[model samples]
Target: MTPMQLDLNLLAALDALLEEGSVAGAADRLHVTAPAMSRSLGRIRRSTGDQILVRTGRTMTPTPYAIAVRAQVHALLQQVQGVLAPSHELDLTTLERTFTLRWHDSLVALGGAALLAAVREQAPGVRLRFIAESSTDSPGLRRGEVDLEANANPPAAADVRAEKVAETAQVVVVRPGHRLAGEPAQPMTAEQYAAADHVAVSRRGNLSGTIDDALARLGLARRVVATAPSEATALEFVRDSDLVVTAPQATTRRASADLGLVVLPLPLDLPPASVYLSWHQRYDTDRAHAWLRELARTALDAPNRRA
Candidate 1:
Protein backbone atom coordinates (compact mmCIF):
# COMPACT_ATOMS: atom_id res chain seq x y z
CA MET A 1 0.00 0.00 0.00
CA THR A 2 1.06 3.62 -0.60
CA PRO A 3 2.17 5.64 2.45
CA MET A 4 -0.86 7.95 2.05
CA GLN A 5 -3.29 5.04 2.23
CA LEU A 6 -1.67 3.55 5.39
CA ASP A 7 -3.50 4.39 8.68
CA LEU A 8 -2.09 4.32 12.21
CA ASN A 9 -5.46 3.28 13.66
CA LEU A 10 -5.56 0.32 11.24
CA LEU A 11 -2.09 -0.73 12.46
CA ALA A 12 -3.34 -0.59 16.05
CA ALA A 13 -6.35 -2.76 15.08
CA LEU A 14 -4.03 -5.19 13.28
CA ASP A 15 -1.89 -5.51 16.42
CA ALA A 16 -5.00 -6.23 18.50
CA LEU A 17 -6.32 -8.83 15.98
CA LEU A 18 -2.96 -10.69 15.90
CA GLU A 19 -2.88 -10.77 19.73
CA GLU A 20 -6.58 -11.69 20.30
CA GLY A 21 -7.07 -14.02 17.23
CA SER A 22 -10.84 -13.16 17.06
CA VAL A 23 -12.78 -10.07 15.86
CA ALA A 24 -15.00 -9.96 18.99
CA GLY A 25 -11.98 -10.47 21.29
CA ALA A 26 -9.98 -7.72 19.50
CA ALA A 27 -13.03 -5.38 19.74
CA ASP A 28 -13.12 -5.97 23.52
CA ARG A 29 -9.36 -5.33 23.82
CA LEU A 30 -9.65 -2.03 21.90
CA HIS A 31 -12.82 -0.89 23.73
CA VAL A 32 -14.57 -0.56 20.33
CA THR A 33 -17.88 -1.98 19.00
CA ALA A 34 -17.69 -5.22 17.00
CA PRO A 35 -18.81 -3.45 13.79
CA ALA A 36 -16.12 -0.73 14.18
CA MET A 37 -13.46 -3.35 14.78
CA SER A 38 -14.54 -5.29 11.73
CA ARG A 39 -14.34 -2.15 9.55
CA SER A 40 -10.84 -1.44 10.91
CA LEU A 41 -9.85 -5.04 10.15
CA GLY A 42 -11.14 -4.70 6.58
CA ARG A 43 -9.04 -1.52 6.09
CA ILE A 44 -5.99 -3.24 7.60
CA ARG A 45 -6.49 -6.20 5.25
CA ARG A 46 -6.69 -3.96 2.19
CA SER A 47 -3.61 -1.93 3.33
CA THR A 48 -1.53 -5.04 4.04
CA GLY A 49 -2.97 -7.24 1.22
CA ASP A 50 -3.25 -10.14 3.68
CA GLN A 51 -6.04 -12.32 4.98
CA ILE A 52 -4.54 -11.41 8.47
CA LEU A 53 -6.86 -13.85 10.33
CA VAL A 54 -8.64 -16.98 9.09
CA ARG A 55 -11.55 -18.92 10.68
CA THR A 56 -11.27 -22.66 11.11
CA GLY A 57 -14.65 -24.06 12.26
CA ARG A 58 -15.76 -21.53 14.95
CA THR A 59 -12.37 -20.07 16.09
CA MET A 60 -10.02 -17.60 14.31
CA THR A 61 -6.20 -17.93 14.00
CA PRO A 62 -3.55 -15.39 12.84
CA THR A 63 -1.63 -16.00 9.59
CA PRO A 64 2.13 -16.68 9.66
CA TYR A 65 2.86 -13.01 8.73
CA ALA A 66 0.73 -11.54 11.61
CA ILE A 67 2.46 -13.77 14.18
CA ALA A 68 5.89 -12.73 12.90
CA VAL A 69 5.21 -8.93 13.06
CA ARG A 70 3.05 -8.78 16.24
CA ALA A 71 5.98 -8.18 18.59
CA GLN A 72 7.46 -5.46 16.32
CA VAL A 73 4.11 -3.58 16.24
CA HIS A 74 3.82 -3.72 20.06
CA ALA A 75 7.40 -2.40 20.44
CA LEU A 76 6.72 0.42 17.95
CA LEU A 77 3.67 1.58 19.98
CA GLN A 78 5.72 1.56 23.19
CA GLN A 79 8.43 3.72 21.56
CA VAL A 80 5.80 6.24 20.38
CA GLN A 81 4.43 6.48 23.92
CA GLY A 82 7.89 7.18 25.27
CA VAL A 83 8.48 9.96 22.73
CA LEU A 84 5.21 11.76 23.68
CA ALA A 85 5.77 11.69 27.44
CA PRO A 86 6.57 14.89 29.43
CA SER A 87 10.14 15.74 30.40
CA HIS A 88 11.56 14.91 33.82
CA GLU A 89 12.41 17.47 36.52
CA LEU A 90 15.59 19.48 35.96
CA ASP A 91 18.63 19.15 38.24
CA LEU A 92 20.26 22.61 38.52
CA THR A 93 23.41 21.28 40.15
CA THR A 94 24.30 19.27 37.08
CA LEU A 95 22.67 21.47 34.39
CA GLU A 96 25.30 23.55 32.62
CA ARG A 97 23.98 26.69 30.87
CA THR A 98 25.00 30.22 29.93
CA PHE A 99 22.54 33.14 30.13
CA THR A 100 22.93 36.58 28.52
CA LEU A 101 21.19 39.56 30.09
CA ARG A 102 20.98 43.11 28.67
CA TRP A 103 20.50 46.11 30.93
CA HIS A 104 21.52 49.64 31.86
CA ASP A 105 24.93 50.05 33.46
CA SER A 106 23.47 51.17 36.80
CA LEU A 107 21.66 47.85 37.40
CA VAL A 108 24.91 46.00 36.79
CA ALA A 109 26.50 48.24 39.40
CA LEU A 110 23.75 48.15 42.06
CA GLY A 111 22.37 44.62 41.83
CA GLY A 112 24.72 42.78 39.46
CA ALA A 113 27.07 41.69 42.24
CA ALA A 114 24.25 40.44 44.44
CA LEU A 115 22.46 38.74 41.54
CA LEU A 116 25.60 36.85 40.50
CA ALA A 117 26.18 35.70 44.06
CA ALA A 118 22.61 34.44 44.42
CA VAL A 119 22.63 32.53 41.12
CA ARG A 120 26.06 30.99 41.68
CA GLU A 121 25.01 29.53 45.03
CA GLN A 122 22.53 27.08 43.48
CA ALA A 123 23.56 26.94 39.81
CA PRO A 124 27.31 26.64 40.03
CA GLY A 125 27.71 25.50 36.45
CA VAL A 126 25.66 28.38 35.03
CA ARG A 127 27.37 31.52 33.69
CA LEU A 128 25.89 34.99 33.10
CA ARG A 129 26.85 37.66 30.54
CA PHE A 130 25.50 41.22 30.68
CA ILE A 131 25.26 43.54 27.68
CA ALA A 132 24.08 47.12 27.34
CA GLU A 133 20.55 47.88 26.13
CA SER A 134 20.28 48.60 22.44
CA SER A 135 18.63 51.73 21.08
CA THR A 136 16.33 50.17 18.44
CA ASP A 137 14.42 46.89 18.31
CA SER A 138 17.27 44.39 17.86
CA PRO A 139 15.01 41.27 18.19
CA GLY A 140 17.89 39.58 20.06
CA LEU A 141 15.53 37.80 22.42
CA ARG A 142 13.29 36.59 19.57
CA ARG A 143 16.31 35.26 17.71
CA GLY A 144 17.56 33.46 20.88
CA GLU A 145 20.73 35.56 20.95
CA VAL A 146 19.84 37.16 24.27
CA ASP A 147 18.36 35.06 27.07
CA LEU A 148 17.03 37.93 29.20
CA GLU A 149 16.80 41.73 29.38
CA ALA A 150 16.38 43.61 32.65
CA ASN A 151 15.79 47.36 32.66
CA ALA A 152 13.77 50.19 34.14
CA ASN A 153 12.01 50.49 30.77
CA PRO A 154 11.81 47.49 28.48
CA PRO A 155 11.02 47.36 24.80
CA ALA A 156 7.37 47.66 23.71
CA ALA A 157 7.36 44.49 21.56
CA ALA A 158 4.19 42.44 22.14
CA ASP A 159 6.08 39.19 21.53
CA VAL A 160 8.39 39.87 24.48
CA ARG A 161 7.26 38.69 27.94
CA ALA A 162 8.15 40.81 30.98
CA GLU A 163 7.78 40.63 34.76
CA LYS A 164 8.17 43.53 37.17
CA VAL A 165 11.07 42.64 39.48
CA ALA A 166 11.44 45.85 41.44
CA GLU A 167 10.11 49.41 41.71
CA THR A 168 12.49 52.39 42.10
CA ALA A 169 12.02 56.12 42.49
CA GLN A 170 14.25 58.75 40.91
CA VAL A 171 16.31 60.75 43.35
CA VAL A 172 18.52 63.83 43.04
CA VAL A 173 22.19 63.31 43.81
CA VAL A 174 25.16 65.66 44.00
CA ARG A 175 28.66 65.97 45.49
CA PRO A 176 29.12 66.45 49.24
CA GLY A 177 29.60 70.23 49.18
CA HIS A 178 27.14 71.09 46.42
CA ARG A 179 24.81 74.05 47.09
CA LEU A 180 21.67 71.86 47.23
CA ALA A 181 23.37 69.48 49.67
CA GLY A 182 23.37 72.25 52.30
CA GLU A 183 19.61 72.76 52.06
CA PRO A 184 18.01 73.03 55.52
CA ALA A 185 15.08 70.70 54.72
CA GLN A 186 15.48 67.11 53.59
CA PRO A 187 13.56 67.54 50.30
CA MET A 188 14.40 70.67 48.33
CA THR A 189 11.75 72.61 46.39
CA ALA A 190 11.41 72.45 42.60
CA GLU A 191 12.86 75.99 42.23
CA GLN A 192 15.86 75.05 44.34
CA TYR A 193 16.46 71.97 42.17
CA ALA A 194 16.01 73.93 38.92
CA ALA A 195 18.51 76.54 39.99
CA ALA A 196 21.40 74.05 39.87
CA ASP A 197 23.17 72.91 36.67
CA HIS A 198 22.32 69.31 35.80
CA VAL A 199 24.10 66.37 34.16
CA ALA A 200 21.61 64.14 32.28
CA VAL A 201 22.15 60.46 31.57
CA SER A 202 21.11 59.35 28.09
CA ARG A 203 22.42 56.39 26.17
CA ARG A 204 21.62 58.28 22.96
CA GLY A 205 23.45 61.38 24.33
CA ASN A 206 20.27 63.50 24.29
CA LEU A 207 20.39 66.43 26.70
CA SER A 208 16.68 66.21 27.61
CA GLY A 209 14.33 63.61 29.08
CA THR A 210 11.35 63.15 31.42
CA ILE A 211 13.09 65.46 33.91
CA ASP A 212 13.06 68.26 31.38
CA ASP A 213 9.42 67.62 30.52
CA ALA A 214 8.46 67.71 34.20
CA LEU A 215 10.46 70.86 34.84
CA ALA A 216 8.84 72.67 31.89
CA ARG A 217 5.40 71.95 33.29
CA LEU A 218 6.36 73.65 36.54
CA GLY A 219 7.30 76.81 34.56
CA LEU A 220 10.92 76.15 35.53
CA ALA A 221 13.74 74.27 33.82
CA ARG A 222 17.17 73.02 34.91
CA ARG A 223 20.26 73.94 32.93
CA VAL A 224 21.62 70.68 31.52
CA VAL A 225 25.32 71.42 31.04
CA ALA A 226 26.37 67.94 29.95
CA THR A 227 24.92 64.61 28.77
CA ALA A 228 26.59 61.30 29.67
CA PRO A 229 26.18 58.03 27.89
CA SER A 230 25.45 55.95 31.00
CA GLU A 231 24.40 56.32 34.64
CA ALA A 232 27.90 55.50 35.84
CA THR A 233 29.35 58.27 33.71
CA ALA A 234 26.80 60.80 34.95
CA LEU A 235 27.49 59.85 38.56
CA GLU A 236 31.20 60.31 37.99
CA PHE A 237 30.61 63.82 36.60
CA VAL A 238 28.38 64.55 39.57
CA ARG A 239 31.04 63.38 41.99
CA ASP A 240 33.83 65.64 40.64
CA SER A 241 31.67 68.61 39.62
CA ASP A 242 28.57 70.40 40.95
CA LEU A 243 26.19 68.99 38.34
CA VAL A 244 23.06 67.46 39.88
CA VAL A 245 22.36 63.91 38.70
CA THR A 246 19.02 62.13 38.86
CA ALA A 247 19.07 58.37 39.03
CA PRO A 248 16.93 55.37 39.94
CA GLN A 249 17.20 54.50 43.64
CA ALA A 250 17.59 50.74 43.20
CA THR A 251 20.58 50.86 40.85
CA THR A 252 22.34 53.99 42.12
CA ARG A 253 22.41 53.43 45.89
CA ARG A 254 25.76 51.62 45.94
CA ALA A 255 27.41 54.03 43.52
CA SER A 256 26.11 57.04 45.41
CA ALA A 257 27.38 55.70 48.73
CA ASP A 258 30.79 54.87 47.27
CA LEU A 259 31.09 58.32 45.69
CA GLY A 260 30.07 60.03 48.92
CA LEU A 261 27.31 61.82 47.00
CA VAL A 262 24.23 63.24 48.71
CA VAL A 263 20.96 61.58 47.68
CA LEU A 264 17.75 63.55 48.10
CA PRO A 265 14.10 63.09 47.14
CA LEU A 266 13.16 64.53 43.75
CA PRO A 267 11.54 67.91 44.17
CA LEU A 268 9.04 67.34 41.36
CA ASP A 269 6.38 64.64 41.33
CA LEU A 270 7.78 61.97 39.01
CA PRO A 271 6.59 58.44 38.40
CA PRO A 272 8.62 55.67 39.97
CA ALA A 273 10.76 53.60 37.63
CA SER A 274 9.43 50.05 37.19
CA VAL A 275 12.27 47.56 36.81
CA TYR A 276 11.35 44.49 34.73
CA LEU A 277 12.96 41.22 33.68
CA SER A 278 11.96 40.36 30.11
CA TRP A 279 12.40 37.35 27.85
CA HIS A 280 11.11 36.00 24.58
CA GLN A 281 8.03 33.74 24.75
CA ARG A 282 10.04 30.96 23.12
CA TYR A 283 11.75 30.16 26.45
CA ASP A 284 8.50 29.99 28.46
CA THR A 285 8.50 26.20 28.96
CA ASP A 286 12.27 25.66 29.12
CA ARG A 287 13.07 24.33 32.60
CA ALA A 288 16.50 25.95 32.79
CA HIS A 289 15.13 29.24 31.51
CA ALA A 290 12.32 29.15 34.07
CA TRP A 291 14.85 28.52 36.84
CA LEU A 292 16.89 31.58 35.82
CA ARG A 293 13.78 33.77 35.54
CA GLU A 294 12.69 32.76 39.03
CA LEU A 295 16.19 33.39 40.30
CA ALA A 296 16.12 36.94 38.94
CA ARG A 297 12.68 37.68 40.46
CA THR A 298 13.80 36.41 43.86
CA ALA A 299 17.00 38.46 43.81
CA LEU A 300 15.20 41.66 42.84
CA ASP A 301 12.32 41.12 45.30
CA ALA A 302 14.46 40.45 48.34
CA PRO A 303 14.94 43.50 50.62
CA ASN A 304 18.13 45.51 50.02
CA ARG A 305 19.68 48.50 51.77
CA ARG A 306 17.86 50.94 49.47
CA ALA A 307 14.47 49.29 49.90
Candidate 2:
Protein backbone atom coordinates (compact mmCIF):
# COMPACT_ATOMS: atom_id res chain seq x y z
CA MET A 1 0.00 0.00 0.00
CA THR A 2 1.28 3.51 -0.79
CA PRO A 3 1.78 5.65 2.27
CA MET A 4 -0.03 8.97 2.47
CA GLN A 5 2.30 11.91 3.07
CA LEU A 6 1.54 14.32 5.88
CA ASP A 7 1.95 18.08 5.52
CA LEU A 8 5.26 19.52 6.76
CA ASN A 9 3.20 22.06 8.70
CA LEU A 10 2.28 19.34 11.17
CA LEU A 11 5.95 18.40 11.62
CA ALA A 12 6.89 21.99 12.35
CA ALA A 13 4.04 22.25 14.87
CA LEU A 14 5.11 18.99 16.54
CA ASP A 15 8.71 20.20 16.79
CA ALA A 16 7.65 23.38 18.57
CA LEU A 17 5.38 21.41 20.90
CA LEU A 18 8.17 18.95 21.72
CA GLU A 19 10.58 21.83 22.34
CA GLU A 20 8.24 23.77 24.69
CA GLY A 21 6.51 20.80 26.38
CA SER A 22 3.42 22.95 26.81
CA VAL A 23 0.52 23.30 24.36
CA ALA A 24 -0.05 27.02 25.03
CA GLY A 25 3.68 27.77 24.84
CA ALA A 26 4.02 25.85 21.55
CA ALA A 27 1.02 27.75 20.12
CA ASP A 28 2.61 31.07 21.17
CA ARG A 29 5.97 30.04 19.71
CA LEU A 30 4.47 29.04 16.35
CA HIS A 31 2.13 32.04 16.36
CA VAL A 32 -0.91 29.77 16.18
CA THR A 33 -3.95 29.23 18.34
CA ALA A 34 -3.99 26.44 20.94
CA PRO A 35 -6.73 24.56 19.07
CA ALA A 36 -4.81 24.83 15.78
CA MET A 37 -1.65 23.46 17.46
CA SER A 38 -3.64 20.56 18.90
CA ARG A 39 -5.11 19.73 15.46
CA SER A 40 -1.57 19.71 13.91
CA LEU A 41 -0.33 17.40 16.69
CA GLY A 42 -3.32 15.07 16.03
CA ARG A 43 -2.36 14.91 12.33
CA ILE A 44 1.26 14.19 13.28
CA ARG A 45 0.18 11.31 15.51
CA ARG A 46 -1.84 9.73 12.68
CA SER A 47 0.99 10.10 10.12
CA THR A 48 3.64 8.71 12.50
CA GLY A 49 1.46 5.75 13.62
CA ASP A 50 2.53 6.45 17.21
CA GLN A 51 1.09 8.05 20.31
CA ILE A 52 3.85 10.71 20.03
CA LEU A 53 2.68 12.82 22.98
CA VAL A 54 1.11 12.24 26.40
CA ARG A 55 -0.27 14.91 28.73
CA THR A 56 1.41 15.41 32.09
CA GLY A 57 -0.18 17.41 34.94
CA ARG A 58 0.73 20.75 33.30
CA THR A 59 2.74 19.93 30.14
CA MET A 60 3.12 17.42 27.31
CA THR A 61 5.76 14.69 27.17
CA PRO A 62 7.30 13.15 24.04
CA THR A 63 7.06 9.44 23.31
CA PRO A 64 10.11 7.40 22.25
CA TYR A 65 9.25 7.85 18.54
CA ALA A 66 9.09 11.65 18.83
CA ILE A 67 12.51 11.69 20.43
CA ALA A 68 13.89 9.46 17.66
CA VAL A 69 12.65 11.76 14.89
CA ARG A 70 13.60 15.08 16.53
CA ALA A 71 17.18 15.17 15.31
CA GLN A 72 16.23 14.08 11.80
CA VAL A 73 13.48 16.67 11.64
CA HIS A 74 15.83 19.46 12.60
CA ALA A 75 18.43 18.30 10.12
CA LEU A 76 15.92 18.37 7.29
CA LEU A 77 14.82 21.89 8.24
CA GLN A 78 18.42 23.09 8.17
CA GLN A 79 18.94 21.55 4.73
CA VAL A 80 15.84 23.26 3.40
CA GLN A 81 17.09 26.61 4.68
CA GLY A 82 20.56 26.13 3.24
CA VAL A 83 19.09 25.32 -0.15
CA LEU A 84 16.81 28.35 -0.21
CA ALA A 85 19.23 30.89 1.20
CA PRO A 86 20.79 33.25 -1.28
CA SER A 87 24.54 33.28 -1.78
CA HIS A 88 25.63 36.86 -1.30
CA GLU A 89 28.12 38.24 -3.80
CA LEU A 90 31.42 39.07 -2.15
CA ASP A 91 32.84 42.61 -2.12
CA LEU A 92 36.53 42.14 -2.84
CA THR A 93 37.95 45.27 -1.24
CA THR A 94 36.19 44.82 2.09
CA LEU A 95 35.53 41.08 1.99
CA GLU A 96 37.53 38.93 4.36
CA ARG A 97 37.42 35.20 3.70
CA THR A 98 39.87 32.35 3.92
CA PHE A 99 40.21 30.25 0.76
CA THR A 100 41.87 26.86 1.03
CA LEU A 101 43.99 25.65 -1.88
CA ARG A 102 45.71 22.30 -2.34
CA TRP A 103 48.69 21.61 -4.58
CA HIS A 104 51.96 19.76 -4.95
CA ASP A 105 54.94 21.66 -3.48
CA SER A 106 56.55 21.85 -6.91
CA LEU A 107 53.79 24.27 -7.91
CA VAL A 108 54.25 26.31 -4.75
CA ALA A 109 57.93 26.74 -5.46
CA LEU A 110 57.25 27.54 -9.10
CA GLY A 111 54.04 29.61 -9.04
CA GLY A 112 53.18 30.55 -5.43
CA ALA A 113 55.10 33.83 -5.44
CA ALA A 114 53.35 35.13 -8.53
CA LEU A 115 49.93 33.81 -7.45
CA LEU A 116 50.05 35.50 -4.05
CA ALA A 117 51.13 38.79 -5.58
CA ALA A 118 48.13 38.78 -7.91
CA VAL A 119 45.69 37.94 -5.11
CA ARG A 120 47.16 40.64 -2.88
CA GLU A 121 46.71 43.23 -5.57
CA GLN A 122 43.06 42.32 -6.15
CA ALA A 123 41.80 41.21 -2.76
CA PRO A 124 44.00 42.47 0.05
CA GLY A 125 41.67 41.13 2.72
CA VAL A 126 41.79 37.53 1.54
CA ARG A 127 43.82 34.92 3.41
CA LEU A 128 45.28 31.79 1.86
CA ARG A 129 45.06 28.35 3.42
CA PHE A 130 47.24 25.89 1.54
CA ILE A 131 47.84 22.14 1.64
CA ALA A 132 50.80 20.55 -0.12
CA GLU A 133 49.76 17.01 -0.93
CA SER A 134 50.68 15.22 -4.12
CA SER A 135 47.35 13.36 -4.42
CA THR A 136 45.21 16.33 -3.44
CA ASP A 137 42.29 16.34 -5.85
CA SER A 138 38.79 14.79 -6.51
CA PRO A 139 37.86 14.16 -2.86
CA GLY A 140 39.39 17.45 -1.71
CA LEU A 141 37.38 19.57 -4.14
CA ARG A 142 34.06 17.78 -3.45
CA ARG A 143 34.56 18.16 0.32
CA GLY A 144 34.68 21.97 0.03
CA GLU A 145 37.89 22.02 2.07
CA VAL A 146 39.85 22.75 -1.07
CA ASP A 147 38.96 25.60 -3.42
CA LEU A 148 41.64 24.75 -5.99
CA GLU A 149 44.12 22.03 -6.88
CA ALA A 150 47.28 22.94 -8.79
CA ASN A 151 48.99 19.93 -10.30
CA ALA A 152 52.35 19.45 -12.03
CA ASN A 153 50.58 17.38 -14.69
CA PRO A 154 46.86 16.99 -15.17
CA PRO A 155 45.46 13.90 -13.55
CA ALA A 156 42.63 11.88 -15.12
CA ALA A 157 39.14 12.73 -13.86
CA ALA A 158 35.75 13.10 -15.55
CA ASP A 159 33.88 16.44 -15.84
CA VAL A 160 36.66 18.15 -13.88
CA ARG A 161 37.25 21.67 -15.21
CA ALA A 162 40.92 22.16 -16.02
CA GLU A 163 43.04 24.29 -18.32
CA LYS A 164 46.71 24.93 -18.83
CA VAL A 165 47.74 27.63 -16.39
CA ALA A 166 51.37 27.39 -17.41
CA GLU A 167 53.49 25.44 -19.84
CA THR A 168 56.84 24.09 -18.65
CA ALA A 169 59.42 22.00 -20.37
CA GLN A 170 61.63 19.50 -18.61
CA VAL A 171 65.07 21.10 -18.26
CA VAL A 172 68.30 19.58 -17.04
CA VAL A 173 69.54 21.92 -14.30
CA VAL A 174 73.19 22.09 -13.25
CA ARG A 175 75.19 24.46 -11.07
CA PRO A 176 77.37 27.10 -12.72
CA GLY A 177 81.06 26.25 -13.31
CA HIS A 178 79.98 22.63 -12.99
CA ARG A 179 81.62 20.04 -15.26
CA LEU A 180 78.74 20.33 -17.80
CA ALA A 181 78.11 24.11 -17.77
CA GLY A 182 77.38 25.95 -21.11
CA GLU A 183 77.07 22.61 -22.93
CA PRO A 184 74.54 22.75 -25.76
CA ALA A 185 71.29 21.34 -24.31
CA GLN A 186 69.46 21.28 -27.60
CA PRO A 187 70.11 18.32 -29.88
CA MET A 188 71.18 16.44 -26.77
CA THR A 189 72.08 12.77 -27.31
CA ALA A 190 70.33 10.19 -25.10
CA GLU A 191 73.76 8.78 -24.15
CA GLN A 192 75.02 12.23 -22.96
CA TYR A 193 71.73 12.83 -21.04
CA ALA A 194 71.80 9.53 -19.08
CA ALA A 195 75.52 10.11 -18.36
CA ALA A 196 74.85 12.14 -15.14
CA ASP A 197 73.35 10.94 -11.82
CA HIS A 198 69.95 12.63 -11.47
CA VAL A 199 68.18 13.92 -8.38
CA ALA A 200 64.51 12.89 -8.56
CA VAL A 201 61.62 14.85 -6.94
CA SER A 202 58.61 13.27 -5.28
CA ARG A 203 56.38 13.48 -2.21
CA ARG A 204 57.01 9.84 -1.44
CA GLY A 205 60.53 8.54 -0.86
CA ASN A 206 60.21 6.59 -4.16
CA LEU A 207 61.69 8.44 -7.20
CA SER A 208 60.26 7.56 -10.64
CA GLY A 209 57.62 8.95 -13.06
CA THR A 210 56.66 9.50 -16.74
CA ILE A 211 60.09 10.95 -17.47
CA ASP A 212 61.70 7.68 -16.45
CA ASP A 213 59.20 5.71 -18.50
CA ALA A 214 59.97 7.77 -21.60
CA LEU A 215 63.70 7.28 -21.07
CA ALA A 216 63.21 3.52 -20.74
CA ARG A 217 61.23 3.31 -24.00
CA LEU A 218 64.17 4.91 -25.77
CA GLY A 219 66.50 2.26 -24.27
CA LEU A 220 68.13 4.91 -22.05
CA ALA A 221 67.54 5.95 -18.46
CA ARG A 222 69.13 8.40 -16.01
CA ARG A 223 70.44 7.24 -12.65
CA VAL A 224 68.50 8.74 -9.71
CA VAL A 225 71.05 9.41 -6.97
CA ALA A 226 68.69 11.06 -4.47
CA THR A 227 65.01 11.95 -3.87
CA ALA A 228 63.47 15.05 -2.22
CA PRO A 229 59.95 16.41 -1.63
CA SER A 230 60.60 20.01 -2.59
CA GLU A 231 62.70 21.92 -5.12
CA ALA A 232 64.63 23.70 -2.34
CA THR A 233 66.28 20.46 -1.32
CA ALA A 234 66.99 19.62 -4.95
CA LEU A 235 68.71 22.96 -5.43
CA GLU A 236 70.66 22.44 -2.19
CA PHE A 237 71.96 19.11 -3.49
CA VAL A 238 72.86 20.61 -6.90
CA ARG A 239 74.67 23.54 -5.23
CA ASP A 240 77.34 21.31 -3.67
CA SER A 241 77.49 18.34 -6.06
CA ASP A 242 77.85 17.64 -9.76
CA LEU A 243 74.50 15.80 -9.73
CA VAL A 244 72.23 16.95 -12.56
CA VAL A 245 68.45 17.30 -11.95
CA THR A 246 65.46 17.74 -14.24
CA ALA A 247 62.72 20.15 -13.13
CA PRO A 248 60.06 22.43 -14.64
CA GLN A 249 61.61 25.20 -16.72
CA ALA A 250 59.97 28.04 -14.74
CA THR A 251 61.31 26.80 -11.41
CA THR A 252 64.76 26.12 -12.84
CA ARG A 253 64.89 29.61 -14.39
CA ARG A 254 63.68 31.34 -11.21
CA ALA A 255 66.30 29.66 -9.03
CA SER A 256 69.07 29.58 -11.64
CA ALA A 257 70.90 32.73 -10.54
CA ASP A 258 70.39 32.13 -6.80
CA LEU A 259 71.17 28.42 -6.82
CA GLY A 260 73.61 28.68 -9.77
CA LEU A 261 71.66 26.18 -11.89
CA VAL A 262 71.25 26.40 -15.68
CA VAL A 263 68.53 24.96 -17.97
CA LEU A 264 69.22 22.41 -20.71
CA PRO A 265 66.59 21.14 -23.13
CA LEU A 266 66.06 17.39 -22.98
CA PRO A 267 67.32 15.62 -26.09
CA LEU A 268 64.78 12.80 -26.38
CA ASP A 269 61.21 13.57 -27.41
CA LEU A 270 60.18 14.68 -23.90
CA PRO A 271 56.66 16.05 -23.76
CA PRO A 272 56.04 19.57 -22.39
CA ALA A 273 54.86 19.44 -18.76
CA SER A 274 51.94 21.74 -18.05
CA VAL A 275 50.57 23.01 -14.76
CA TYR A 276 46.76 22.82 -14.72
CA LEU A 277 44.01 24.63 -12.82
CA SER A 278 41.50 22.07 -11.53
CA TRP A 279 38.24 22.68 -9.68
CA HIS A 280 34.87 21.03 -9.11
CA GLN A 281 31.69 21.86 -11.05
CA ARG A 282 29.85 22.89 -7.88
CA TYR A 283 31.36 26.36 -8.03
CA ASP A 284 31.39 26.57 -11.82
CA THR A 285 29.66 29.94 -12.06
CA ASP A 286 30.54 31.50 -8.71
CA ARG A 287 31.87 34.97 -9.40
CA ALA A 288 34.21 35.33 -6.40
CA HIS A 289 35.48 31.80 -6.84
CA ALA A 290 36.11 32.38 -10.54
CA TRP A 291 38.08 35.52 -9.68
CA LEU A 292 40.52 33.53 -7.57
CA ARG A 293 40.86 31.00 -10.39
CA GLU A 294 41.61 33.83 -12.79
CA LEU A 295 44.31 35.07 -10.46
CA ALA A 296 45.92 31.66 -10.43
CA ARG A 297 45.80 31.50 -14.24
CA THR A 298 47.38 34.96 -14.49
CA ALA A 299 50.08 34.00 -12.06
CA LEU A 300 50.94 30.91 -14.06
CA ASP A 301 51.06 33.13 -17.19
CA ALA A 302 51.21 30.52 -19.94
CA PRO A 303 52.67 31.81 -23.20
CA ASN A 304 49.20 31.72 -24.74
CA ARG A 305 47.06 31.77 -21.59
CA ARG A 306 44.70 34.13 -19.77
CA ALA A 307 43.84 33.82 -16.06
Q: Pick by lDDT: which candidate is best?
A: 1
Put down candidate 2 lDDT per residue, 1-307, tens digits, no spaces. Answer: 1134667566567767766767787899779999998888777777777877798776678888878877577545545545665788778888687888887776776667777887888789988887778532346664345788887656566645777777767787777766655455535567777877888877676678887888899888788989987777888888888887787777667676676567667766777777888886666767778989988887666432421
In lDDT terms, how accurate is model 2?
0.73
lDDT of each: 0.81, 0.73
In candidate 2, stretches whose alpha carbon ends up further than 4 angstroms from where it belongs are 1-90, 134-138, 155-159, 182-188, 302-307
Worst 10-residue lDDT window, candidate 2: 298-307
Q: lDDT (0-100) at residue 115 of candidate 1?
A: 79
Steric clash pairs (candidate 1)? none
Error of 1 at 33 (Å): 56
Write the residue-wise lDDT of candidate 1 on 1-307 in tens digits.
7857687677667777877789998899789999999999888888778888988999998888888888687656545545665788989889788899886777677667777997798889999999887766577785456898877776688868988888878999999988887755665889999999999888777888898899999999889999888888899999898899898877777778888888988988899888888998666777888988887776665534348
RMSD of each: 17.7, 10.9
